[model samples]
Target chain A: MSRATILSAILSNQPQTTQLPEDLQFDCPAKAAVTEKFIQMINLIGGRVVEIQRIEDINLYATAHYGAGERLITPIEELDFYTQFAGDEDPHQFENIAFAVFKTHFAVAENGAVWITEDRMGARVLPFICQHLGMLVFEDSIVSNMHEAYQLIGSQDYGFGTFIAGPSKTADIEQSLVLGAHGARSIIIFLLKKEL
Target chain B: MSSIKHPELSDIFNKDEERVNWHDDTLWWIRAKRDKAAHGISEWELLRETASQIKNNVLSNLHNYLIEFEEKAQKNGIKVHWAANAEEHNKIVLSLLQGKGINQMVKSKSMLTEECHLNEYLESNGIDVIDSDLGERIVQLAKEPPSHIVLPCIHKKKEEIGQLFHEHLGTEAGISDPQVLTETARIHLRKTFLTRRSALTGVNFAVAETGEFVVCTNEGNADMGAHLADIHIACMGIEKLIPKKKHLSVFLRLLTRSATGQPITTYSSHFKKPRKGQEMHIVLVDNGRSVQLGREDFRNSLKCIRCGACMNTCPVYRRSGGHSYHNAIAGPIGAILAPNLDMKEYADLPFASTLCGSCTNVCPVKIDIHDQLYKWRQVIVKEGYTSSAKTVAMKVMDFTLSSPTRFKLAGKIGRWTLKHAPFTVNNRLNLWFKNREMPEAPEESFSEWYKRNNSI
Candidate 1:
């Protein structure tokens, strides 16, 4: 009758599987090249990219901004950088930019999409909070559907994850399709080369 | 305990039948949009069938799956609570807020909350609950219940909303522009979103496998409120659960298309875990669902996704207006479901529909709404709850029809009386004839004509 007792009964009946795919492998060497290609793709989509270095953290960073006619960037290394840009601190700081491109574990070249799990963004809110969000996908991890992609990251723990297709869009207002409403204005897929 | 029902609203509608025509046309336009969006996908029907079956399986195994969902949600640092009824659900939420020492909260549109009158209850307890959705906010300010679930202020014109905003929000008077009025509300609600320490939203779908709840919205208000708040409470009916994530793909594909004819809602935020400094709670409310679920004829009503497609496509709903049902939910779907909550109290609702069957056709989950309404009528009538006048009339008709001699004599008398006294039969005393003209008495009854034409 207790909730725990019922849950145990349900889980006991479930079939559990833990098998890894042969082709599903992470390539750590492509990280830098993927970052560059991501920047190029953002530029190609009419976004401005700015590179900055932090002396205290000893890390390089870049931020891309696109919305209206303004292009602003926040360094990737800084904490709460996106929030500051998104005007969490000030209510008047609403920007007309599309999305922010971030480096991710891997990219699926098959669909020209990027993989950003909840772990990298710290929260699922980040990807949706921006107007347009772009993720750097390494050439190796792209697959046809979610089923194949899940098999690659076998047994890896994550809080949450999602496969975003494109820019935030809706046709609900008046049946006229508007690409951007609250979240990312547009999503640009950056397909990085094999070598950095 | 009988309050005088507002006969004037019904009277006004009766006088201006054109308003019903306009209302029907508006809802039909949205129905057409749904059809267009649904037909574009090749696997649309298959997806609906799968979603329906998945929900059916979950309902059949609900006791087990609910336990699974609660356990996984608790493991993810989300607290879960159960309420046997609406009062209990509101009490649990208030208790949670009292424990947090919070007094103010912002809420996204939740029909479950509306059914429970949670805002009025919370305010009675001295807590300020602000409605963040534009449509809900309009109706909230008016101190009136929402006429439609999806479009809460659908019955009101922009001019009325402009006046309300100007009076309450200090906007320039005489400005009826939607864009300007909407922007004003957006800015006003943005302040509430930032200051409110707690937020409440409705659960569209809860995946039993992952222990996650999905809340869909157009303005992203639900997400904004939840993400910014210290405490996020999601109120869901017990029937919202689905068995797996793959099942969500099927539902998500059909829900928006059926509800508003959109490819997808603007925001479909999945809440799985409580963020770093926030707390999450889910209250599963079962006010009258368990009792309804036990009824074999009406249990399928539980499968409804609250898409409002049924209402949009329902001809009777558009003409009668939602307020006619006098329940938290309205329209054809509401007619069937409301009676199950309180058969005597909501008896009029079930008889409100014309049994056209358009609602079932447009239903994304296929609930057989009109059939259920018809069934409720029979149940109500059998319970001796029919009005005294109607009961007497039915008895007289039964007596006359059961005897051929009595029927023939009654028919001849009726014709003679009608022909002699037209004004008496076609007066205001007969409310049915108020808007209709009575046909002149035939020269002879149909049976009399038949007897003369052929051997009887």
Candidate 2:
């Protein structure tokens, strides 16, 4: 088979193996300012950030903005929805989703991306198929950069995962900015405030 | 310059002065955005170094990593296929689709598939494949190859794309707004995604430590296509593998920043195990990578992450346009890589660069792109792959420069001819005069001026 031939050829020609670089060390300051950076970056990438105190505030924001009959879906039990997703269902049935919200494990400050896995998303397609997407992250669950984000995700097991940064966007046509491409037309980050 | 019918393809692209200038300015703006993004990260240079070292380790132990990757991916219930070349890769995809009795598929942006010409191959085999990326879809509608890797239809103007969408997707005439055009595509491709039974995507990184593969996209097209389809096929080159999943931190931070200057693409989804009742297949394609690996001097090119930074920052590429390179991937990186695939056909590519070193400076993994471009030139000339006219010109340049008397006399004659008979050097035979007018003969030779000034 071609596999053996290709492997042997690579072994013959490849340079002697070199060691991977040591674990990266960040000497930069601003590690404590991750929350500020996350808010700034998310806004820059066209995602709106709403600071709220209670879990119920998400519904307040959604109800104020969305019409009554819109198909708004969320995993948050406090919020109203037509049905609960059992995490195992046909993805095709989720089409025409006006808005979908889910809780994230943590968020990255450097890129405004929130880490969400299949457990949080009933289906892998829910985050991307909706017209609008809302990701709720705990105020304290923010990391400075990807290095720390990976450290938090160390040795974790999941079927699927992603870091959703911004709403789907494209500059393909003449470098023109279009907010919604195929994914969510808009992304709103509902940053929950800590209660005393 | 390589063909009898077309004078250098770049020259043809240059005929439209307005388009050429617009293309140059647009890419340079993207390069500026890259600079700003890279500066935001304090550890930018260190990250580049770390990525480079990791890739060096990957290349040296690629054979081991490939097998480890195969074992893990198969254990995850993902079928792994090995393709020796482009033909076999295409055949594997066709059989997979045919076995399922599916005739249509949706694909995301995978430069590997572009390198393999998968769409054309699939179409020939009676399968319909729609490219879901907006830029790719535009060029696909035009039935033309993508000019830029990251921005497939960068060479096109808004009016032209509006025209394509109007003809193909039934948009109203004279709709030149990019927003309108993009929304039209979103609605059209959404249907294709919902209805298609098969989806094929290109792998960005295949982790050896785990069975997972990551597909990054800004449009979320890959997720839409793969998640909805019954059968999912992901193709990757042998060189796309890394030893562990942790290394992704270094690459993910560098990838989008260097490309389009976004902190990260909108979606960086990791696919490990297939969903229940769904099929996931990965084709580990060699397709001349082994040969490129055996080439000791050029093997480092296999570490490319397919980011378009080099093209955006390349001076020659920006002005001359991507079609000038005449390959699936265009830009400085492609120049070095194209020659590895076919020395005879791509010998002209290495000569396309100005050796500006801008491409190397912006390269995320710190590929010595200019040096590789220079090295490929030497190999091409030594292998006798250069054009006969160029060979003779180089020989003449050598013969004249080696002797001072001949050099001085030749300089005198060149000045005399330029001053007395401009037509001789201003004709089509003069390649330099093709794209630009010959500079007026210098008032006097530098040496002559030096000699006169030295006496004072």
Quote the true-contact fraction of every model.
0.05, 0.83
Per-residue alpha-carbon lDDT of candidate 1 for residues B205-243, written as tens digits (9 for 90 to 100): 897777888888766668767876889999999889987
TM-score of chain B of each: 0.95, 0.96
lDDT of 2 by residue, B40-97 (tens): 8878999999999999999989989998999999998999999888988999999999
Off by over 4 Å in 2: A27-32, B1-7, B434-456
Model 1 clashes, total count: 14
Candidate 1's displacement at residue A8, Å, is: 17
Worst 10 residues of 1 chain B by lDDT: B1-10
Per-residue error at B453 for model 2, in Å? Answer: 7.5
Q: Give stretches of model 1 more than 4 Å off.
A: A1-117, A120-124, A127-196, B1-9, B12-19
lDDT of 1 at A131: 54
Number of clashes in every candidate structure? 14, 1
Chain B TM-score against the true chain B, candidate 1: 0.95
